[model samples]
Target: RPSRPASRRDDALYRKADFPWYGLDAAYTGPRWLMQAAVAGDGAVEHGSLGHGEEPSVRTEGGADKER
Candidate 1:
């Protein structure tokens, strides 16, 4: 079966930001991806996170949920 052509919008997972993005460190170089970017009111990135290496996994802590 023929598949539909991929569009630029479909391929775009991350939004454009004015700030520079970096990995964990200079020594560690691996697969990198844009996680998220925090944009200020003036349209400037305050801080953001860039994912590298393996994707993180979710793990519950504090021995399950407890009413506080």
Candidate 2:
């Protein structure tokens, strides 16, 4: 079967990015931050939300959750 075309709603903005940290402080941290901001459910800290000013809550490795 042929693949269906993606709609505007299926854009990258609607996708999620994963961040894998190997160590406490790594060079890839920069990229991880970028990816998180790009597709993070809570949205970017600078942008303060993509469509809404309210951002979602994000869980941290410290067993705590924070809002973006």
RMSD of each: 8.4, 13.9
Each prediction's TM-score against the native?
0.44, 0.18
Residue by residue across 1-68, what tens digits does model 1's lDDT show?
Answer: 00123244322323445445555565555656555556678865676665565666864565679989
Model 2, runs deviating above 4 Å: 1-3, 13-16, 19-41, 44-68
Q: How many residue pairs clash in each candidate?
A: 0, 0
lDDT of 1: 0.50
lDDT of 2 by residue, 1-68 (tens): 00123244433332432333223243322222212223335652322122222233664566556778
